[model samples]
Target: MHDDPRLEELVKQVRASRKYSAISEALVRRIGAAELCKRATLQDAVKATKKTLHQIAGLYLANAHPPYDAWLRQIIQAPDDTARRAVLRSIMNHHTSTRERLPILDAFYARVLADLGPVRSVLDLACGLNPLSLPWMPLAAGATYHAVDIYEDLAGFLRAALAALGVAGKAEARDVITDCPTDAADVALLLKALPCLEQLDKAAGAAILDTINARCIVVSFPTRTVGGRQVGMRENYAARFAAMIADRPWRVERIEFVGELAFRLTR
Candidate 1:
């Protein structure tokens, strides 16, 4: 049999990079799940694996719901802070993971922003309705925020919300896997997004981190899966994330909160 150079090289790339080790595991998980999803076929395993991979290669996030767009629009039209916060609650309750993280949003934002002094601009990657939490963030007056998400309708609603609130925030539909946005900012957020990005493309995720022009990058990961499973996720993700930055030029600081893990990186 002839040697397959491409597969050999891919194996070398996966084995040599510790950061990619976690990504490789994620791929294995996907393949196993996909395989089981087609187990009735009992034939053409390669075809099934290939088809499943293509379907997911460019997926951005798992918890996307277009039905929330109307709720976001209502929040933008809210008459007062009391009304807006109430509207925000409805939006938050739509997703359990986001809902859990938001009640402590004030303290969470304080910790992420406090360490990165004097922020004038922000970049929020894969920003779900988290951009709606802008009211709670300790942002400088007139600080410009640029955010992106794959859900165009949700992003459009956020763009309208930013204008309604008189904050200099911009939300646009984007696929970070294909074209990661890079604008200079005092701080850039990757909250609970790295794993998803890596799952899409580890090379793209690493490249996004390497190329983004920001003073600090804040990364957060969930301690519990969306299904409420807590099978060593924190330790597993943290070790892989540390490996991702092992050769990069940044000072790392870790912040731990119940059911969540965070890191502040500055250079």
Candidate 2:
């Protein structure tokens, strides 16, 4: 933290924004001057709580995907007016709960860690701003972790987060659909980041899904509903994903749909 005037300015801006009052309050409470001092060198408590905050942020948005979806649709079709940027930023600022992410992570750990011997590597796909799976690094023990994402900001964040957590990993900005490296791993985790929506084109998504054939694949997606309507306005992607893998050597061991997302852990 080290008394960053920049963060101070961000806090001020967040508080001053009328639309971001709730987030402003939460952000202010989460980082005080003293906490900021400790955050710089990656103090134990700050690191741990920031880790938790990261999870909270993901679940927060995952829960809001439904309303967020409607908001996005309206913005996309809003005639490209001056209000578009404001609307999009507001939608992006929406948050998710950390409580929800833990349960899903716990379940994933339970299933994957079972009888996992000599597990020494991981390939994480579409790692977002927080790299939700970074918390599992220690548990991964002697493994080398590699993460890829389309967002350079997120990839950089993953590098920083892992460094702060005292874990080693490599992260790169690459299209998950086009730049999957030749290297393989004992496990591949795709935490709610299956590029299905981004692709939009069924053929492209199918190709992306086809390339992944790790010993284990953890696929998660926004569930069927958020504010009563499906998050993606459709639930067919789950079936489509299944169809893509039907003839592969892998087998779907479990499929759990929670909140606005679903988790599929297959082997």
Candidate 3:
């Protein structure tokens, strides 16, 4: 998180914007002006405050690096707790607005569920602290969900979130680039993970796609920035993905851009 340039730019934008004015002022008053100067960004300060609040509330979930932590800290320090809670609750109900590129995740779920009828199980690849594909959990009501990811801590975090949401799913420790299970998945989801491959080569990403022997695969790439920040354009992903499945029997069903993200549904 510290090395991400995108994060750095986002922090700068947040500091200069009116959105975080009240929270920033509250933090400076509570934490002191001198302490705020020591940190690189206000987001960092918010993170520290949220840690304290979470510790106080004893609300520990398996989900590590929860984005709500920052929001919670801002809300708690506000003058009115009721209004703060209401605002934060509404934010949580929506997809993370902080993300640079946001695809309509719910629509993708609907399409996937309708496409893959009566699937036995699902394997969600690169599942981070937040499980974006959670809605599909109901489709395979009794099926085992094997969520795999490089972030080892994410497994516990996802397990807790699933439990809290009353979703029955299992988490497995896996690095998609290095190791992908041979277990057949009825459907596979590769969503917004291509940008996280800082060290891995393009071939590694392609390998994961090749290994997922599912009936249908739903993959998406961010097309533009939702926050008006600079990000690497995913210009060649479609061609690369198409090449991987060229020799396969699957047929491409949909390829369209939604907001700043491009989605492809192949069956």
**RMSD in Å for all candidates:** 9.1, 18.1, 12.7
> What would the TM-score be for candidate 1 when compared with the true structure?
0.74
How much is 54 displaced in model 3, in angstroms? Answer: 25
In model 3, the runs with Cα more than 4 Å from the true position are 1-103, 130-133, 136-138, 225-235, 260-267
Please tell me which model should have the higher TM-score, number 1 or number 3.
1
TM-score winner: 1
Show the colliding residue pairs in model 1: none
Which residue pairs in model 3 clash with each other? Answer: 62-157, 63-157, 223-260
For model 3, how does the per-residue alpha-carbon lDDT over 142-260 read when each residue is reduced to its tens digit? Answer: 66576875433445655655554445777765646556776787877676665443223446656677678777776766555544444555555566656766776666754554543
* Each model's backbone clash number: 0, 14, 3
TM-score of each: 0.74, 0.54, 0.56
Give all candidates' CA lDDT scores: 0.69, 0.50, 0.51
Report the lDDT tens digits of candidate 2 across residue range 1-267. 535655555455434433333332333434433355555443443444344333433233443123533653555564653455444334434433223354455454555445545557777775543343444333457567787754344455556545544467787766554455557777676755554324323465456555765666666665543334555523566676767777766666645535424444445
Winner by TM-score between candidate 2 and candidate 1: 1
lDDT per residue as tens, model 1, 1-105: 013233333334433443223223334334434454455542343345444433432222233334555765687688999898778766766644466687677
Q: What is the lDDT of residue 145 in candidate 1?
A: 85
| C-alpha lDDT of candidate 3 relative to the true structure | 0.51
